[model samples]
Each structure stands twice: as structure tokens, then as C-alpha cells.
Target chain A: MTVRVLLADDEHLIRGALAALLALEDDLVVVAEAATGPEALAMARAHRPDVAVLDLQMPGADGVTVATSIRDELPSCRTMIVTSHGRPGHLKRALAAGVRGFLPKTVSAQRLAELIRTVHAGNRYVDPELAAEAIAAGDSPLTAREAEVLECAADGAPVAEIARRTSLSPGTVRNYLSSAAAKLGAENRHTAVRLARSKGWV
Target chain B: MTVRVLLADDEHLIRGALAALLALEDDLVVVAEAATGPEALAMARAHRPDVAVLDLQMPGADGVTVATSIRDELPSCRTMIVTSHGRPGHLKRALAAGVRGFLPKTVSAQRLAELIRTVHAGNRYVDPELAAEAIAAGDSPLTAREAEVLECAADGAPVAEIARRTSLSPGTVRNYLSSAAAKLGAENRHTAVRLARSKGWV
Candidate 1:
């Protein structure tokens, strides 16, 4: 039986080329394509594909968040995430969101097809190197809000800007940043951001 | 005569698929492929393709740097840059490096094929929106060393680490950082980083 799949990535070149390559496989067919997380979720709702292959970073939302939504809305549609940046935190997040497959953009087309089938069969598939790195990296000590604030601070935005972006008060943002710095044993928010980034935590 | 082309992108899937798709054209032939900027330069030296299509972001160096080298070493081979992130400063840098083409990764395969031909024919092509943005963004005020220091400081690393990374003394790093901040009218190194990033200067 052929596996119907939804492919979503922000890069039009990657998405189009990947669709063409996957079409060469006899047992796999791409049902739809999307260029963002929201579009991927919308396509999933419309097509009911057997598998949803999403890029980890997209405009509207991340692949993990989309996968979580798919899990809640379309239980039968197994989701997977592919990323050129296979960060440990991203891998952990995807697995937590019940993503059936986690692989790098460097994977061969044949291997990706096989993983798609594996995922369709209700089996989990993660790149072994990525999995090992995740184990070595350990879990992040920062809470969700702390991590989010750190990510906002990654661009070196001021506390007021971060607060505006997060829709939180400036005081709250400062508190989260301080707590994150403390948890990471950092002397300041800048150091905290650097530390979290090194661990793939933010 | 058919145009010989070299494809260089770190994303294996995108490169493989792009190579496969480009092979379908009658007047185009992919002579070699590489996954890094340095490797791209090596392949260009070996294959001497008429057109070298490179990704802007790669492991060893950037496409602009590679293009500059190719222009110096193999004057006959024209170069183009394809990027998912088409920053204004990057566009300016590529153009100054004597690159013949600048395009986003979202372009259609057929359009890319045409661009390869255009670049091979000694004509230039750039995405219009990117060009507009580049023009609007204006030139970066930072010098090469200042820009380098700002990029190093971007990760929130301490001055000592930035010095080690750049092979400069800590005082020199501090001087460059301060100069960059002053030029950008930023209060501190962190704010300077944010400003430079927004301007695509680093």
C-alpha cells in the first residue's frame, strides 16, 4: 500500500526537490506541500496523509508544536520532523510531542522513504547520532518561560523589547531572565543565553 | 555547447534533489557537487565548471568568500549564490565579490535553470525584492575587523573568548567591539549586536 505524506519546509527549493525525489519511490506519494507550520497543519487537516514530514523551524510555529497539534486533532496521521540543525533540545522536544521520526536533512532519499514507511507502521525512528547527542546533552534546567525568554534574548534585545514580544510585563521578563541565569550558573542574562544556546536549550 | 555547473549546498537532500532536477535540462549539466564552501572551491578547481551555484551559508566559509576565491583563481568560472536567508549585507557582500547571480532558495527549479544559464552567459541576476531591501538597508558602517568582532560578540561570548576565537588580543577585541558599537550608535556591545543583525551587517 502506498503511504500518503505531507511535506512542509520553508525552503521552496528543498520542499519541491524533496517532493520530486520522494515521488520516484513506488510506495510513497506526497499528498501535499506547505511552506510553514500553520500551512502544514492545514494541509494535514485537508489531506489526512498517513505521515506528516515537517521542517523543525518554520514561520508560524515549530514542527514540534505542529506535531503536537496533529497528535491532538488527527491521531492517525503520524508526524515527523527533519532539520538541518539537529539540536539536542529540538530532538527531545519532538520526541515529547510524539513525533514518530526525527532525522537530519542530510539523510539520503532512500533512507527517508524507509523511515516514512517505518513511521507509518507505528515505529519510531531517530537518527542514532542525534539521539546520542541528546543523551549527552542532558535535559535543560530552565522552565518553558525561562527558555522562551532566553530565546528572545538571543538576539540581544533589551528586556523591554523581549517583554513586548512575549506579551509579558518588563518585570516578569527580568525575573525569568534572572532565574534562567541562576539556573545555568551564569553571571548575567547574556552569559545565560550563551550557555543555554551551547546546550541547545534555547 | 552545454553549460557545466557545480552545485554546492550543505543540505544533502536539497543538493541531491537539485542536482537531479537540474539534470533534466537540455543545456545544463551538473559537473560536480560539494557540501561546504571550501569543498565547493576545491570542486570548482577540479571541474572548472562554467557556473558555480553555491549556498550562502556553508560549513567552512560563506558563498561570498568562495565566490571571491573562485573569481581570483578561476576567472573563467562565473559564480552565483543561493540562500534561504538573503540578508541585505550578504547581498552586498556577494555582489562585491564579483558574484553574477543572487537568488533565494524559494525560486522554482526551472527559474534556477534559467539563472544558471544567465550566469554562464556572463549576465547577472538578483531577486528584485532582495535588491530593493539591500538598497534600502544602506551600506554597513563597520570595517572587516569590526564586523568580525561584532559577529563573535553576537553569541554573547565574553571578550576573552571572542579574542581567542579571532586570534586577537583581548584589548584589540574590546577596541573593535567599542568601535562597532559607536559606529552603530549602540549603547553597548549587546545592543550593537542587535543593531548589526537587524541591518544584516553581521
Candidate 2:
């Protein structure tokens, strides 16, 4: 039985090397490759690969967004995040997005191949060390709405613009921003956005 | 005369495509390819290509740092910055590092090939649109020390650590932070860092 894989990363060398390394497995076949988030989604939809390996950060989309899109569009396709950033916030987001595997770029090629097999088998795999740190870091402080607000703010969007984009009233947007700031112990909206981004909450 | 080129981009697809595109020209040859700044530097030092095309943000070393190293090690080898980030601050930094060309990743393959020839011929080239915006953005408000302090603060480092790293006293570090914050119209260190980053000043 062959497992089709979709590999997506902004870095060319890593993607090419990973694809080559995975090709060594007789049962694993690289069906598609993408360099950006939108491209990843498009390729996944077209190829219907059994497993999608993604880098967390890309030009058009982050891993969580790509995973969410894949899960919604292709429920049978499993997704994994392979990133250099082992931050708890990133893990939390990937988990929330229903990503089946969370592995760091530091993982050996053999471990990565094994994890791919595990994920393709309809099972979840997370790095034990990262999972422990995520547990110690606790859950994200921001609610889904608050997280959305902060993420929007991180782009330097104004209150009205964020409200419009998030489909909330301006007052509601302000409330979320203020609450998020207080929760993160940030002195202002910019600080809240920065802190939330650093924590991977947004 | 065939111009030897060193291409360094973290992404594999882009680098490969660019190399292929440039190879189509009669007198352009990609002599080396690298995925990280350090590797690019090493390859450039060894190959001493006529021109080096580098992505601005890469692991191990950044484009600015790599450019500086190449400039120091191979004084005759011209360098070009090929990046997605078109911020005035990034341009300023690249120019300060003595990069001969500043081009956006959106540039057509034809234009990029032409720019390489120009840069290799010892002429300066900057994307016209970016040059206009950079001129309109005016000069950076923060001094070298203040920019350094704000950049360090962005990492959530303590004032004492930043002071030690920058070889300044703790009080001096605090003063620079506060001044940078004021200059950027930010209320705190985090906000200052965010604003500075947005403006490409840090």
C-alpha cells in the first residue's frame, strides 16, 4: 500500500531534501510540493494526498490555517506540522486546528518518516518534549474571538477595521483588545499583539 | 564573459527556478547555491563569484550579515539582496551593508537576470517602486545604538542583558529604549519594537 504525501515549505532546500529522503521509503510517494500556504491548499485539494507535511510559517499562510483548510476540505487527509519553532503557542494552535502530527525541523529523517507513517495510519504524533513544555505553558489565555482580534491587530489594523473584518461591533472589538491586553499583562494594544504573537496565541 | 553567480535562498523551488532561468542566458552561470546565510558566505568565500544573490531572511545568518561578510572577505564580489520584504528599513540596512542591488522577489525572471548582469558589471540597481517608497519614508529616526537596543528588547530580553550584549551600561540601555519608544510614538518597549519593525527601522 502506497501513501501519497504533499510536502509544503517556503524553504526550497529543506523541501527538496525531505522529499528525497522520504522517497527512500518504498511505500511513501511524494505526489505534490508547494511553497506557500495557498499553494499548499491548492495542491492538497488537487492531489488528495494521504498525508500533508507543512512548515509552520510561509508567505501566504501559516501551518494552522493550511491544516484547518485541509481538514475542512479533505477530512481523510492527515496533516502534520514540521517547524523550527517549537513554541507552545504554535503547538497549541496546530492541535486546535486538528493537526495530527507536530514535529520539529530538528527531528531526524528516520523519525520524520516514522511519524509520517504514524500520521497516515489515522493516529496522532507529537514530540514528547514539546508536549511537556506545552503542558507546562498551560492553555492559551485568549478566547477564539480574542485571539482573532489580536491577530488582526498584529497586522496594525484599526479598531473599526478589525471589527468589520471579524464581524463584530467596534465596542466588542475594543473589549476583546482590552481583555487580551489585561490577560497578557500588556500595557497597550501593540504590546498585546506582540505578546500574543510571541506566545503563539495569535 | 560568463558572469559567475552565487544564489542563496532558503526556499528550494525559487532558488532552483532562478538558477535555471539565469542559466538560460548565454553569459550567466550559477556557480553555487546555498540555503542558509552561513553556507552562502562560505560558498561565496570559496567560489568568489562575480555576484551573489541572497534572500534577506535566512537561517544561520541574515542577508545583511552575509552581505557584510562577503563584502569583507571578497571585496571584488558584488552582492544583491533579493527579498519579499520591501520595507524601507531593510533597504537602508542592505545599502549600509554595501549591497549593490535591492530587488523584490516579485521581480520577473527576465528582470532579475538583467539586474544580475547590471550588478555584476559594477552598477547599482534598486527596484524603482521600492526606491520611491524608501525615499518617501525619509531617514530612520533612531540612532545605531537605539536601533540595536530596540532590536534586543524585541527578543524580550532584560535591560541588563541588552546592556551587556551591546556593551552599554544598564542605564544607557534603558535610556535608548525609552528614546526609541518615544521616537516611534510607542508607550513601552514591546510597542516600540513592533512599531520599529513595521517601519523597517530596526
Please name the candidate that would achieve the greatest DockQ relative to the true structure: 1
| DockQ for candidate 1, C-alpha atoms | 0.63
Q: Taking the tens digit of each residue's C-alpha lDDT, what string does model 2 give over B21-47?
A: 677789999999999999999999889
Model 2 ranges off by over 4 Å: A1-55, A58-61, A82-86, A100-202, B1-3, B9-39, B58-61, B84-86, B105-118, B121-124, B144-182, B187-189
Tens-digit per-residue lDDT, A13-101, candidate 2: 45665676678789999999999999999999999999999989898999889999999999999999988667888898899899999
Candidate 1 local lDDT, residue B174: 93
Write candidate 1's Cα lDDT for A111-189 as tens digits. Answer: 8889999999999999999999999989998899999999998867888899999999999999999999999999789
lDDT of 2 at B202: 75
Per-candidate TM equals: 0.90, 0.63
- Candidate 1 per-residue lDDT, tens place, B1-202, comes to 9999999999888899999899989999999999998999999999999999999999999899999999999999999999988889899889999999999988989899999999888899999999999999899989999999999987778899999999999999999999999999987899898888877898
TM-score of chain A of each: 0.86, 0.81
Q: What is the C-alpha local distance difference test score of candidate 2?
A: 0.86
Best by lDDT: 1
Stretches > 4 Å off in candidate 1: A143-152, A157-179, A182-187, B143-149, B158-187
